[model samples]
Target: MFLFIRSLLKSPLAVGALVPSSPQLSRLIASQVCCGNSHVLEVGAGTGSITEALLNLGLPANRLFVIERDPSLVAHLYKRFPNIQVRCGDAEHAAAILCEEGISEVQTLISSLPISNLNGDNRIAILEGMMNALAVDGQLIQFTYTANCPFPAKRLGLHAERVGRVWMNIPPAVVWKFTRASYAL
Candidate 1:
């Protein structure tokens, strides 16, 4: 908790919150993932909060991969979730990270990163990498505290729907489940 707070204080834009995501929000995000063939990839997995929720929801640890940019948080995640893999890298470079980790595609990509705070290029790159890594029927689960789409789907020719909302969080949050352009709502 102290580590997360310190990171958040040091870099508000990067950390995006005064505290880690609420477990309820984490569980809500995890519940959106359905059983599938391809593996699951989680981005910005700070302190493994969302990872733990996914694991508790019966996701196979071996089939789950997490990427956290901060080396310190990555180290904490590694120590916390020893059975799971945690790669220290940027979400914009997800494709390369996955390829380096022997993952061609994923059935789901759940993200804890704050897209609203990232710059246009970084946001586009992250979304592009996610789209490239997901399967045909895959989903991208992203949560934001804002009322509307933080990463507007219309800009990317994609579609997003509110799958769940957690008012119990520090400032409340909404989980928007995004799908491919052709399959969007």
Candidate 2:
């Protein structure tokens, strides 16, 4: 109850995205990438909307590492998803965080970040961070309201493929799956 308000204030953008992820979209994301018992790094975990979906899809809380920059939202997340390791920091520094956690690479990276809001440098940094931290065959799934890829996927040596779209979501969003150019298992 109280947490919802806090989430709203701290994450007006995220709040606008839809607090509870749609079942169909969640299932689509889970089916496209998430495999049982794999390490996943979730960025911009605002209000834990996607976090809820991830957990509901059977990814254990302990196996997931969430990174959020807002303190108030981070507090709210801690209260809601107590078992998750909530890092109150930027996702651009995910490489350092993953190393600190003794995680060599993550099998999947899920993001609810409003990449379209970020400038070129920051966007590139976040994308590069995720790419470098991802394991072989790892996948990055991100959602955006725009139909096109949020980042210059091809310029960055990433292959972007639209997995699905959720018109039921606020403003209607498209899910993009990013794989490294030379991705090999």
Candidate 3:
């Protein structure tokens, strides 16, 4: 109710529509998945704003795994989208999910967690887990209000590029696209 509306207003990019409008289902669907055959791993699927977008973007519901830490949010996800495998846990435990799913690699990873809100160690751990779960050609899309790349985008031995910006967003935010740097043969 109030929380859902607050979330919608907080992240304008996550939910494309302004108030009293249908959810911005398109923006959420826009992600880093390549070739349309990607296993998407989304972190901080708050209120399923991005989750709904992911589904609308044609990312197969079965192949998409959402990790939400808040129990209330997880309940919301389950109620809204019963088909999705919404797990109630921390994103830092991402590796466990990978192992449980027998997912050797992910094609794309999208994170909306307030990386700025995490402690240094927890932030590092979560990013490292995502790196561990990604394939060689996998891509990661993350958004932040900061002017710089969040966390160790490159410090983790991963190459990062600021692909685009969404000024229409409430606080205005930038989108970073990360990938493994190419090694010459």
Candidate 4:
């Protein structure tokens, strides 16, 4: 908790939430990952709450990769999940980070980023980078505190679905899943 609060105080925009993700929200986000051997990537892993949930769901540490912009949070994640690959970087460079880690694509990309708060260019860059790192049939699972879709899914030629909502969270959150439009049917 101290780590989260400290990180939040240090960078409100990057940390985004007053508290780390609630267990309900974490599980809900982790549930989006399909049962498979394919790789998984998580961005904005603040204190690794969702990352813990993902591991609890049986995702191998070796196959799970995480990117956190805050150096402190990145260090925390490294100490918390030493086996998992945790990088300190921006989500806009997720594709490059994955490539450096020798991951061409992931089956699921989970983001805890504050997408709605970012400006147009940053939002597009981050989302596009995420999409690029995802497999053709992969899914991007994101949560927001708003009722609306976090990103302009249709405008970006992506199919979006409101998967679930976790009202038990601090400010409550809605989960949305996005996939390439052509893959939707």
Candidate 5:
């Protein structure tokens, strides 16, 4: 908890929320996860609360990869989930980061990034990369404190749907799922 608070205080923009993701919100996000071997990329894995939930929900550790911008948080994640692949990079460079690792595509993306804190360009790049890297039937799950959709999926030519609302979280959050605009499944 001290680590989370210190990181949050050091970088408000990167951390976004004042607290780490609650187990309730994490489980809510995991409930939408599709069971498969395709890689699951988690953006902004702050202290890895959601990562734990993902693993508990049956996602294999080898198939799970996470990117955390803060070096401190990255170290913490590494210590927490030693078997999981954890990267230290910004969400905007997620595509390139995965490409460097020879992973061209992923099946699911679970993000806890504070898109509301990002500027338009950065946010778009992050969202666009996530959309492009996703498999055709892939789902991008994001939880936001606001009631509205944070990602401009419609503007980005993707379909967005509200999958769940986690009222148990401290600030309360809604999960939004996104897929390609033409994807029917």
Candidate 6:
């Protein structure tokens, strides 16, 4: 909690939310990933709440990769989840990070990134990178506090669906799933 507050105070825009994700929201986000041997990537994992939920859902530590921009949070994640691969970097470079980690593609890409706070270019870059790192039929699961879609799904040639909403969270959260428009149709 202290780490989260320190990080939030250091950069409100980067941290985005005032409070860490609630367990309900975390489980809802983690539930999006289907059970299998497929690799999973989680971006902007703040304090690893959702990561814990993912692990609890049967995702192996070796197959779960996490990318957090905040060095402190990255360190926390590393110490908390010793078996998982935790990297400190920007989500816009997720594809490169995954490639450097020897991951060709992931079956599920879960993002806790604050897309609504990013500029147009950064949003596009991050979204494109995430899509590129995903398998052809892979799904991208994202949660936002707003009712609207966090990103321009159709403009990005992706199909979006509002999968779930967890009102028990701090400020509440809505989970959305995205996939290549063609594959989705």
Stretches off by above 4 angstroms in model 6 are none
Worst 10 residues of 5 by lDDT: 28-37
Where in model 2 is the C-alpha error above 4 Å?
1-24, 35-37
Predicted candidate 1 versus true structure: per-residue lDDT over 107-161, tens digit per residue: 8899888888888888888788778888777889999888888776887777788
Judging by TM-score, tell me the better candidate of 2 and 5: 5
lDDT (0-100) at residue 61 of candidate 6? 91
TM-score (all chains, Cα) for each model: 0.94, 0.86, 0.80, 0.97, 0.95, 0.97
- Model 5 C-alpha lDDT per residue in residues 62-103, reported as the tens digit of each score: 999999899989999999999999999977777788889988
Give lDDT tens digits, candidate 6, residues 1-185.
99999999999998999889999999988888973677899999989899999999888899999999999999999999999999999888888999998988898999999888988888888899888889998899999989999888898889999998899997899999999999995
Off by over 4 Å in 3: 4-31, 183-185
Residue 8 C-alpha lDDT in model 1: 82
lDDT of 3 by residue, 1-185 (tens): 56556655676444333332124322733654563565788877777767787777777788888887766667888898888788887777776786787766677888776776667897788787777777777777777767888867545667888877766665566778778777201
Which number leads on lDDT?
A: 6
Q: lDDT per prediction? A: 0.86, 0.78, 0.69, 0.90, 0.86, 0.91
Candidate 5 versus truth, CA RMSD in Å, comes to 1.2
Q: Name the regions of candidate 5 deviating beyond 4 angstroms.
A: none
Give the range where candidate 3 is weakest over 10 consecutive residues by summed lDDT: 17-26
Q: TM-score of predicted model 2?
A: 0.86
What are the runs in model 1 whose C-alpha is more than 4 Å off? none
Better of 2 and 3 by TM-score: 2
Candidate 6 least-lDDT 10 residues: 30-39
Q: RMSD to the native, candidate 6?
A: 1.1
